[model samples]
Target: MHTRRSLLLTAAAGSSIALLGLATPNATALAATSDQGLVDEARITVQDFTGDTQFTDMRRKLARAKGVFIVPQLLKASFIIGGEGGSGVLLAKTQTGWSEPAIYTMGAGSIGLQIGGEASEVMLLLMSDKAVEAILRNEFKLGADASVAAGPVGAGIEAATTTNLGADILSYSKVKGLAAGISIEGAVISARHSRNAAYYGKQAHPRAILYENAVSNRGTLELRQALAAAEMP
Candidate 1:
């Protein structure tokens, strides 16, 4: 059983590594620039989600969201052992407008009969102040630190929207042009302090970046614009 589990994990890691574009011999170099690339990808992800018809419910939720965390490419690999992980950016909706993004990472592992690999664009709409606050921490587990529910998509959007009001966070994801329910109940979201500092050229903390407005980067302007447009009626 132990050997089987190790094989499963190895397979899953290989898939994730490929999805991250780190499977090459030059992976070390690519890793150096991944922070900036992640931000750029995040901008594209927001634009894609807002413009896509399938994400109408997510856009609606974003109108009232206190914050948003966007994972441009969440990778999952499963074959008896399942693992999901990705790097993302988190931004707060402040009284002035959207704040600069702070880096975060999501990862989880589970045992199941699932088989296959998938990559998706994911977003977490922070529905309440509690949800936003919990995410600002150094690390937190989804469904344990804050209430979370899959955001309604397609046919059930209206009904689920009303019923999901009490959930602190609403998650939305898409893969290959179709909406997907990426199970993230036990995922850990932790701050990526080094990335945050590298991106901003200073020591930027999650709270300061999202809440205090302590730093700014011209590169992220497009991402903020996309979020603003998505929230419009």
Candidate 2:
């Protein structure tokens, strides 16, 4: 009777190990599935932002924008001495469309207590040939070297400014899903193309993805079409 009991215990342990081995692949697949969904959701968010009034205006003002870096929701923090924020996507426009997102970091060590916590959408219009060139090199700061300014807003073209710092710079803002008439200035933007590419498992830049003719899903396409209509001449 002891020998039979020992045999049964051994069989149960072996079965448990086999079951665990089978479950491993399913677990890995589930993780991959979740990540894919996240990427798709991010793309949808971009398309939604484009349709927003403020974002639409910014896009129209900078229609000729060669590169656009979009961070869906940028979290900002500030204290008495200094503050910092990191990990956003830098998307560059290509001949075809907008490129895949290149990860980026932005922060400044300054003195001030800008006590607030809000999710902001930052749009960088690369106006200088020098700025564009610098992005290709890697990641570079906006106000650190290049002149960044707040963009104007209105329905009429006359309301827009034609001033260019070797190229034109247009920026806009939105608060809690409402379009803010003011533009965001002083904030810096930089690209981390290498890290971004790694995240996407590609050797390409965000600009490449922007320009591609690939059709975003139904929701994205609809949003793009709406923004296009609003921005039409």
Candidate 3:
């Protein structure tokens, strides 16, 4: 039984590596001149890819999410030889603006083939603060550190799902310029504070950028407007 299980694990890992080959390599470094740049890029990508119709739909869905994290780009590579893929920022809506991105990593397991490779954009909705807080840490793994469940999308949105991480979470995927029904199950997310801080050229905390303020360039005005509109008594 032990040997069989080991073989199965090896096969699953091999399959994941094979799937990643479909992604093209990008030479550009993951650096941002300013938080606004990241936010602007994310907003533009979201609008451009999702289009007015789907973008509107996503926005409405996001608005209803408890929290969202926008990472602009999530570069993922497997340790055991695999292609690399990136996902745009993870954004969570807030009374003021979206929360700063927390970093996490994910790997495919047996039973499901989290196949496909391409630098696509992704959006995650944190249904509970527990999961959100866990992401605030510098590093996190999907299956190891925290439990993750496949997020519901589109018509499946009406159904409620729970995660073992003490929070309810949902995810959606977009490739090139289209929404996909694919589940981002084995994928992980965690904070890249050292890298992110280096990009921003400051000693600022990731939370400051993800939660406290809107760091993107184009969204500053819009974020401010949103905050003003949500001003508390």
Candidate 4:
């Protein structure tokens, strides 16, 4: 039984890796800028979301959002022990403007009988001060550390949804040109210090990068532009 189980697990892991390869064909191009690649991908993701008619409300919310965390490609794979993880960038809007992005990695696990892998884009909007505070900590779990809601979409639906939406964090996902609200209740989101340090040429904390010195990185100029373009009229 032990040997049989080991074989199954190995096969599952292999399948997961294969799926990622097919989804992320630009894997080699991913690290072209080292840490900056995530920033580029994030910009494209924001464009894709706000450009869609279904996300009209999502664009509206952006004007008032305190912060936004974008994971351009969240590669997810699963088997008996399901796990999903991806790296992302977070940018907070302030009186000055959108702050420079900080690196983060979110992951989750589930145990059961399952198979296969998939890829999607995820965006988390920080709606309130409390949500921002909760995320600044070392690590936190969605639906546990703070409240979360699937951001309502469409013009008419948005009005009703926002009125009833009381969650701190709003989640949205896009897959194969389809966009909708999603729940990431059990995922663990944490800071990625190594990525931060490597990109910034020093040890930079999330708090400082998000609030104080967002404009410090010249490479992020395009990212900032992407966010600005997503702004609605």
Top lDDT model: 1
What lDDT tens digits, residue by residue, belong to model 1 across residues 139-182? 98999999999998887578657778789999999886578898
Model 2: lowest-lDDT 10 consecutive positions: 214-223
TM-score to true structure, per model:
0.84, 0.61, 0.55, 0.81
Which is superior by lDDT, 3 or 4?
A: 4
lDDT of each residue in 134-202, candidate 3, tens digit only: 666665454455445544445544344333235356555565456654445555565545435434444
lDDT of 4 by residue, 1-233 (tens): 22432343345334434444342434322322445656766777888888789888777777878888898767667877877777788888888778889888888877778688766789888888887777788897888988888887665774577553687888889766577444478888899765576567667789988887733668888888888778665
List candidate 3 segments past 4 Å from native: 1-31, 34-37, 48-60, 71-84, 87-95, 99-117, 143-167, 211-233
- The lDDT per prediction is 0.81, 0.48, 0.46, 0.74
Candidate 3 weakest ten by summed lDDT = 24-33
Candidate 2: Cα lDDT at 72: 43
| Per-residue lDDT value at 146 in model 2 | 61
lDDT of 4: 0.74
- lDDT at 169 for candidate 1? 92
Candidate 2 residue runs with Cα over 4 Å from true position: 1-45, 54-56, 82-86, 155-157, 163-168, 181-190, 202-233
